[model samples]
Target: MLTIDINKQLGDLDLQVNAQIPMQGICAIFGRSGAGKTSLVNILGGLSTPDNGQLTLGATHLYHQQQKINLPPERRRIGYVFQEARLFPHYSVRGNLNYGNKDKDQVHFDTVVGLLGLTELLNRYPATLSGGEKQRVAIGRALLTRPQMLLMDEPLAALDLPRKRELIPYLLQLAKTLNLPIIYVSHSLDEILQLADSMLVLDKGKVLVNGPLHAVWDSAEMRPWLPVKEQSSLLMATITELNQKYRMSKLSLADGTYLWINGMPLPTDSKLRVRIHANHVSVCINRPTDSSIRNILSSTIAEIIHSESNDNVQVKLAFGDDHIWANITPWACDDLALKVGQAVYAQIKGVSMTESELAQSF
Candidate 1:
């Protein structure tokens, strides 16, 4: 595990954080602009010093205030990828990738090349590569350093939607294949949801919430930061069967509710996490008949949250141990008289159950 207890003052912001981040998979540092997301990662990367704190990664002590030990950036053995690619324009991709290397035995040159899909662009100059291509090369260069941990600060921020889509799969592959820990920093919820295994949310330089992605998703603290229309619940499911005739796949949820989704083919028995958006779900006093909606599960109203605008209410539904959220108008909520522990049917359309980019397979 990576332990951190640090305090720093940057201009008017007094940053303070105390949390234990897991050292396996991707741990995302998430917050809005000026939430000290970058500052915290900078401290972890040895790019900046904390006023007073202790930091330990595995058996190494990267920083200790009492002992006055602060390792230099290079000595920390942490790879960093910033918002920009930051590649050397004067050199070809191959030359830039080999610039800093003393332990060539640790990583194979061709392996890194193929992992980032840079085999075709090895001889191309930085100017000739697209934004996504340059970032891929940058990632390859970082991996070639053989760092113990990787720090990424919105690495996809500069890319357009298509470029971001193209790059996400590569990152997911890296997360699954690489044994090294990754600390990803981003303000975008979509990116965090898709890439992070655990999350550390910051608000005004303080650690608001830090824990596994699923746990944080259900926390009340996270609701305020999420857009009401974008609020959704994550469910872990397994692909049981695929209907080639309908171009849809059947997923078995933990509650034994089978949900169908239309998309690219996924391997059978592959575990996936799906997002059921609040806007796509509607509450019914009783199960409906002859409806176009494909999923209608019996659920209990566990909690109801009135929107700050007073225009809508977010109802939390419980089905077994799993929970889903539904956003309905206040009038509808009053008309139905929803209360805690009230039985209600949740209608979810098949098209509404999207294959999230954030879903992970085990």
Candidate 2:
């Protein structure tokens, strides 16, 4: 785990954070423009110093104000991928990847090149590559350093939609293949939903919430950051079966309840992360019969959040150990007389599978 209890003052923003970030998978740092997302990442990377507090990665102390120990950026063993690729104009892909190394181990270089899909472009220069390809080369160069952690500050912000789409797959592959911790700073919720395993939300230099991505996404603290229509719940599901004739895939949840989506050609038993918007779910007091909806499951009401200013109410429905959210009119809620612990059926109108291929299938 990466433990941070640091305080820094950047102009008017008094940044203070105390949180333990998981060392495995991607931990996304998210907030508004001035929420100190990039500032906190800079501190962790030793690019900027904290005014006071302690920062520790495992057993090593990267910074401690009291102890007067502060490792420089290079000595911190952290790799940074900024918004720009920052490749050397005079060098080929192979040359840029080999710039920092004295040993220049062929095995390591080949492995990183293969991981980032850069072998075909090894002879090309940065100017000849697309935005996505350039970013891949930048990632390869960082991995070749063998750093303990990677810090990416809005790495896709500079790319267009197509470029971002092209680059996301490589990032997902990296998260699955490596054991290294990646602190990703991005303002795009779609990107975070697709790439992050954990989430750290900041508000005005303070930690609003931090935990597993699904949990944090479902938390009340996250609701205010998203618009009513964008509010959604995340689920980790397993592909239990494939219907080739209908081209639909069966996804099973924690409680053995399942949902179906337009199937991708992936093998059965594949894992998928899905997002269901609150507006897409409708609650029924009695299970609907002969409905057009393809996905309906038995659920119990866990919580009801009434909107004070509007006639809308958000209901939290629980199935086994997992939960899904629904936003319905107050009249509908009152008509059903929904209460905590009440059993009902949830009609899921849509499911957004976050896996690149599965998402594109829809």
Candidate 3:
């Protein structure tokens, strides 16, 4: 188990975090830029000293005030991948990788090279590599350290949208191959969905939520810093069918099949993710006549929460075990006579690709 209990002050806000993460899968540290997300991560990495508290991984004591124990960053055997790909500018990819291991051990080198697909670019200098390539090397270097845990501090932030797209899959693969837990810090919800298994939601130096991404994001804006156009809830679904020739994939949800504008990521009869935004779903009393919308799931209303800043109400609808939040105008809710337990069809309108997502095996 990875346990954390911390208290720190950054300017005006006070951060108090006490949480535990299972020693498996990625546990993303998610929040706004100044939410003290990075600070918490730094403390975990031994890069910053916490004012008070204790931290431990399995049996190793990383920090403790009462015990007066604090392990230095180097001795912690933790790997850190910073926002910038901090590769040695003068060294070739191979050299930078070789520097990760203290003894230049044969075991770590070949493993990291093969795992990160670095063999082809071994001779290339850091200056010659693309942003994605540099980041890939950075990851390989991190793996070669043979660390107990990995710390990623917005490792994709410097990369452009396209570069981020190119790198996410490889990072996901890294998470799966290495059993070591990762403390990933980022504000990007898509990145969290693509990689993290759980999250520690922080804001203004305080933790607001900490749990599985699915549980923490239920009908809430999990990360508001994400582009206003793309903020939404993510649902895990299975691949029901693939129409690759037409470039569309059908996903199986508890409610029904959700068709997305992409190829399927997982194999046939495998599970994938389908992101549905509150604004994208239109609530209707009856299934409307044929239209461009390909998804129409019948569900019962669970609850309706009004948006404080607008006339819209967030309608939570349950489909079997899954629930989707749809934002509808209060006036429209009145017109349709919506209420708890009301039968409704969540109409998914105008589906298109904003992220250059390729359906890789999740």
Candidate 4:
């Protein structure tokens, strides 16, 4: 586990964080512009020092206040990929990648290059590479160091839409192929949803909430971060069956409930992350007969949250072991007489998958 209890004062913001993050998959550090996301990452990467705290990754103590033990960035063995590629202008991609490893380990070099798809650009200079290509090289350079963990600070922020899309696949593949934990820092919710298995949300230089991506996403702490219309719920599901004739796939949820989406060519049993926006869901007092909607499940109203600024209410619907959110107007809520624990039917109008393969299959 990566355990930390740190504090620092950055100008007016007092950064205080205490948490134990699992060092298994990508853990995204997310918040607004001044939420101390970068600052926290810097401290973990040994790029910046915390005023006082203890930090330990597995068996090593990166920092300890009482022991007066603090490791420098290089000694920490943490690879950092910044927003910019930061490659040496005079060097080719191969040369830049070799800078971190003077030993010139060919096996590690080839592995990193192949994983990052950097072979084609090996002899190319940084100036000649595109934004996405440059970022890949930077990532490759970092991996060549054989660091205990990888830190990416909004690596896609500097890229345009197309460039950002180009790099996301590589990021996903890298995470799956390597055993090292990745601390990805980004403000973009879309990026976090696509890349992170767990998330650590920072607010005003403090740890707000941290947990599995889906759990944190469904928490009350995350509601304010999203616009009313953009509020959504995430579900991890597995493909159980496919209807080749209709081009549809059935996904099984934790509770054994199933949802169908546009067909994906992937094999059965593939894991997928599903996103259901609140506005796309509608509640019915009774299950509609002969309805055109393909996805409708029996649910009970678990919570009724009134909107402070509008005439709408957010209803939390519990179905078996999973829950989803629905946005409805006060008039509709009253007409349906929705109450806590009241049975209802949720008609999902749309479903989106974060998996790139199903990006256009909604």
Candidate models: Cα lDDT each: 0.87, 0.86, 0.79, 0.86
Q: 224, model 3: CA deviation in Å? A: 8.9
Identify the candidate with maximal TM-score.
1
User: Per-residue lDDT tens digits of candidate 3, residues 1-362?
Assistant: 88899888878868788999887778899888788887887888899888999999889999998999999998888899988899999888988987867778887688778877788999999998988889889988888889888999999999999888777777787778778788899988778777778888887887788888778865254533344345465667766777878766677766664655554445677765556777788888998777678777888999887666666677888887887778788899888889999898988753553333322334
lDDT of 2 by residue, 89-177 (tens): 99999898887655788988887899888989999999999888889999988888888999999999999999898888888777777
TM-score of each: 0.95, 0.93, 0.90, 0.93
Note each model's CA RMSD in angstroms: 1.7, 2.6, 2.6, 2.6
Which of candidates 3 and 4 reaches a greater TM-score?
4
- Tens-digit lDDT track for model 1 on 1-362? 88999999999899999999998899998888999999999999999999999999888899999999999899998999889999999999988888765676534777778878999998999999999999999998888888889999999999999999899889988877877789999988788777888899999999999999888875889886778876778788888988888778888888788778876457788888787888888999988988988788899999999989898899999998898899899999999998999999999888766565326555
lDDT of 4 by residue, 1-362 (tens): 89989999999999999998999789999889999988898999998999999999999999999899999998998899998989999999989999898568898888889988888998999999998999999999888888889999999999999889888878888877877789999998888777888999899998889999889986998885668876888877788998888777888888989888875646788877777888878999989998878889889999999888867899999997789999999999999889999999999853343243232111
Model 2 has how many clashing residue pairs? 0
Point out the higher-scoring one by lDDT: 1 or 3. 1
Report the Cα lDDT for candidate 1.
0.87
